[model samples]
Target: MPNPSDYIALGSQSEEETEPELEEDSEETEEEQQEEGFIPVMESPRVLAEKESKNGEATVCSNAGESGENSQGNEWNRGDIDGLFCPICMEAWTTTGDHHVCCLPCGHIFGFSCIRKWLQQQGTTKKCPQCNRKCTLKDVRKLFASRVVAIDGESQKRIQSLEAKCISLDKKNAALIKKEAEWKKKEAEWKKREALLQRELHQLKEKTIYLEHLLDVKPRTLGHPPSMGGYCVPSLGSEFNGQGPFILQKELGVDGARLFDIDASSKIILMTRRLQGLGGMHVLTKMSLVAPYTRQDISLPTGSKAVRDLHICPSDGSLSLFASLGKKLSVLSTKINNFILAYDLPAPAWSCSWDLNGSHQIYAGLQNGSLVVFDMRQTARPLEFVNGLTSNPVHTIYSLHNSTLPSGVTAVLSASSAGICQWNFGGSEERQPVVLETGNQGACISLAYCPSSDDIIASFRPRIDNSNEMAYSQHLLTPAIGQGVQGSHVHLKRFGSNCYQKLAVTCANVNDVRLPRSAVMNIESHGCLFASGDELTGELVLQELPSFTVIQHLKLRKQPIYDIKYVHDVDGGLLGCLCDDILQLYGNHALK
Candidate 1:
């Protein structure tokens, strides 16, 4: 290891003395060179010269002297010296010191003292120590600054790219923040709307509770009077020794009662009545048949508005089926006093009935002139639907258990405004209904069926003249003997051999100026008796069946009678007559 000072002194000696010293310096290992903090120049001067000449421009070294002098007039600071060093000593260059910053004509930078000493020791040739270019002491230029800085073109381009990337990232971040704010605003609005809806729901529930309470307490003052002035007389042809069979037992006044059904096993009558505050909504009222006759009002499920028809299940006394104007057929459990099953219907239902043949089948008569059949075992949908002969509403339906029909055939009798139709099922693959011919009495308004007698009684309204020619061409036409009568007609017929044979027909003063009225028939040991409301005298008329002969007249109010039901059990016979204002119960005097 030779001393660094000896190498610097050897540069000024004779050529023969310096040649061996130069070889020794060149033989130093790369590790030694790096340890000395010396960086080798990558580009040769010849290559730089060719590149400059091709561009038709002088080398940067040629302009260094002029640039140095021009820079003296501008302000100089320490910041201008970033990343600048002298190539000869590998040390930082200063502004005003013995080893100040300077550049040779070859554009190579060094300390001023280092370059001057290098040129003097090179004798008269005075070549550049870096590029071997001939130069004198006057060719050396001094930089006028407190510090020196070198501009790296590649590093400056890299920093510009990084700055542009940072700007793009900032824009993306701002967009994400804005989106987050918008989502938060939407969430708050939804929460507010939810709170409002919850408040509305609570208010509706309170209103429902109040309305229910009003219905229960408001009708207590309307209790039935002790008597409604009813009387019974002996039948003209009966074998009762000139005494009537039935007498009034009690009267129950249920305000707003529309329809009712009696379950003998449970000894309760289920009736439908409108709510006080909510007139359009109707619910069930259960009344006990015993003394004191305790009553309970039951609220129906939502959407079951006005019930059109109600009936107790013949097979299961605890279950009752009803049709509603709400376009639903619902089965309610009287034991639990709640709706157990419901079915969607296409149109409002007018009547419903259970199969009296001890099957799981049930039937619904729709207002659209269609009959829907359902099996209690399958609740998802109806078993089948049959379209009626006319589009008029089927107001009455009954399941027939006649022994005269075929063994495999099951029959259902339904009556509408058009006529009476017997629907037969299970006999053949294609079962079609047959319309019963009853000599065209009038529009069938109501129907009643007796299982023991296999008899059907249908009431009719006077026929209306719908022909256009008759109204325009009539000059003087005498009406038939009973054609111009204002009252309705009642017909008794037997159903057998897939047809109806007329048994009796009589003019009745009932259902004349009113809507359809219901009638009932009861089986007695002597004979079967039929009862209906007589609008002319405002009385209940009891007539012997198959003859339509009047037996007894029980006086009632002038109000219309909407429904009647009769059932006989171990407790003898019970008769329930529902009028607009009161419900009257009659019992068989002979059986009691």
Candidate 2:
């Protein structure tokens, strides 16, 4: 009848216990003394728990310390955390790591794997499993060091060596510098090809899902159905509850979320791309923040359409779409060509993805210091980016590619008004930046990761609070204004979540002026399908990620367009789109 989490809260609430709970806590003989006079020490999480970005009053206990006071070993890492040696067995992890590791909440180290069974047999209360300091997370590790491991282990020297190797490996990678020029050209070409292929492939799949209409119809034969539960039942030739003579309805639409062509059996993790705007540094507008509303007259030929940011479902490669037409985030789905949500944004959002944990649902980074994490389970209002930002707005987010790092360890390494800062999950540690050089500094605008090669591509610029639309670039830096820099120093942070920290940065491009925040948003990882936009001109630019010189000039389509979608239906194996709202269905036998 009781809630389990409530039990976890209660069970975990041993900041201190009654002398009464003592017999219940017999494990602590020394804890009795500490409880009377010991000061608190810092005890870090064995691994940080899953937490929301927001923080509030914690479950306060009487022992809560005042501000600025550090807990025991809170200043860990200065000395090896695994330095203390066990006086009982006198070695690093006397037996197995599990037989005796540290317990969180109250940092006492113990071999409960042994004491637990010992306690059960005697029907005794567990005091301090170690020195019984009446365990609180703050003093636990210290108690363990003082009691469990009175003598230091030989691990100190080994730890120092390991730490040194880790520090050295963090450097040694100049491969990014060598590949810079080639990567620039290759990125440009791939952009075009990826855009076209992703669009076309998406459309083709959509057509197949609804293509049953393309088949010749045959009349149905109906007989007694399951209606005659216990009796003989006649079968119907119709795919529905019918007989040979009746008509039936064809299949349409999908289940859950939207009109998705997703496979219920799919197990792959899909990575979708969607955004509201882009940011750059500009003399006209100190911070070049551009979204759906900031349009310009670039003087395009007739029929040159602008493509909006796309909504893709990475789970099954199925996609829904959203674009801006009359200054709103339009929802492009199979049911409607443009189901527009009449909403306005401070600046259009640039890009978004599922945070590594898949806990917060989606994290969307806007042009300024405005990143938002939307709970996938709830779409009412997103947890705005500014709420979690301490330094600057998150410009772009990269999914950390690592198996060594735990989930939610790395997040949107924001390129804000100031510099780069990682939005660590909850109150963890801050991420170090491998930002662009000083002169070439501003907010980062875009991010793309090449799985083929281990490179995360990004773009940057300056602040964008005051923006002017047309003829904006001509404005010069005022004597006292336009503090934003050109930012020739955008570098890629490699293995950001690795234990062996690695850094890879981009080369100087003093003259590579980043364009004003535009719709040019997505970077496809599978070597094809790129999407960019001219937000001001309403032109959607689609291309493919190419590798070879010959593959360079490809586009998802030759003509500029406004929106697109990609889907794979149950019947239609794979489909992609360029501009069509309806799916032109076909059979598997039909060749493209």
Candidate 3:
């Protein structure tokens, strides 16, 4: 109907209305959770204005911005809010890329960078203008990032529109919920009447049957409205089993192989299930069934934007996904949809993974040689930034351990366009980053941390020094897995080690055989499997992973598989793939 944006306006209105109360409620719940053990997360703030006053600027660069051992850190800590206020806004706070903790004669903390940028525009400098005290801010504590403001009336208007749309969508959902409840009530009433009618008909039938016997006559027959319930022309007395549903994941990234065959080693079965029905490029968390775990909508900013990567926290079962839009990285929550938070990035984020640090924090690595830690408790800023990384962008961010590490140290590794580096959380950003060069720097395409050894599996363009670096390139470009294995079987390569000294395969083009784009896909959680659909060909392929082996391929009434999944059902976990509007099931022979 009336356009989705209209409803979002209402959503924002509602969010704003209950924000204060929600914040208070959150505070209370946070305290109670502390007794149990939980962490908090995220950022982005409101834009506002204050009465005019004075402007002050703080800049840390050249000698001051140099990386070194932590010198005079926190020495600049001032008391409560004071002189850091902008004369224009008369507000004691402002925000900049660098989360500045400015020392003020009036004791305030705002964006040291934001204030400086504001001062440049005014073309004048005033001393302690807010407190009217002498300007004397000694040390500038620059722990976070620094940003240049590019905002004006246009951007503000755009933000307002998006906020409005979010609110409106929420209202529509609420109304739909109410409508569904009413429909259910009506259906129940109709069902009750139908039951009474059926009883009356049964009585009539019994009476009619007796009369027929007494009169030596035949009773009329009733029939079902034909064919929707199938009548298979089969070899008599034979039974047929239909296909079921299942979950499917595309791959484990370029780092390793998909979960299907396990490199054909002595197979190990840790907890696993293929998530099905995820065909779209974007992976988001929409609603939360578990309370205390905030439920949030996931929506991309309007236009042709797509998320870069997806990660599910094995700890809380929460999902964390990030999008690469511009220079800045937008942190997206699968739990929250319509609402989004922006985090200023030091560099374009190449890759990311979620790791539960100490049960309360989520450690996300960035392209900028550091691990960005988001404390779920405080949305104000990142709790810590673990330093020591390569100069190039960090290509991969992943976890080494599923559980908390011993000695209170968690092993987290990051791969950059240049090389790979590892770090623990308790470190300072002011030290020489422990850098490691993985022999060459030809853009690390993919990386994964092996749980067994501290070793990392990296897929990169081979070094020119190699005798047949050309051969290496060819191998990397090959299609590592495919569908033509058994009659309709898909084949996947098992996991391989990076040392090419371990495994190797190369092909001319992987995209040539690529299927039309899908919106969603899921894999069965049983052991390992992949859901496949070819809308152009009117085919659905359920392929096993790691082995590139196809288990089944079916030709349904040509429908675009928008999503595929393995669902846990009354019979057993089944393969559930969606095409167009209907869902078709493929049951495992065992389930039947």
Q: Which candidate is the best by lDDT?
A: 1
Clash list (residue pairs), candidate 1: 81-148
Best by TM-score: 1
Model 1 agreement with the true structure over 1-592: per-residue lDDT tens digits: 1111111100112334322211122344434533664232244566456545656322122222234346566642433322244556645444344565567665666777888778667665566665566666666787543223344565679999999999999999999999999999999999989856754463354345434534553453245322223434433524554556676666666666778888888889999876444444566888787745666667776786788888898878989898887888989888888888898999988888888886578899988789999988999888888898877778789988847777766778898878888897666568878877777677776788877676777887665678322222111111111222344445556656476677778887644323445555665675778888776677888887777777677776436676788888887888888776478787776565
- Clash number for candidate 2: 102
lDDT of 2 by residue, 149-213 (tens): 23333466788889898777665445556578689999999998985575445434434533432
Please give the clash total of every predicted structure, in order. Answer: 1, 102, 104
| TM-score-based ranking | 1, 3, 2
Each candidate's lDDT (Cα)?
0.66, 0.32, 0.37
Residue-pair clashes, model 3: 104
TM-score-best of 1 and 3:
1
Off by over 4 Å in 3: 1-306, 317-319, 327-342, 357-359, 368-370, 386-389, 402-404, 417-421, 427-443, 448-592
**By lDDT, is 2 or 3 better?**
3
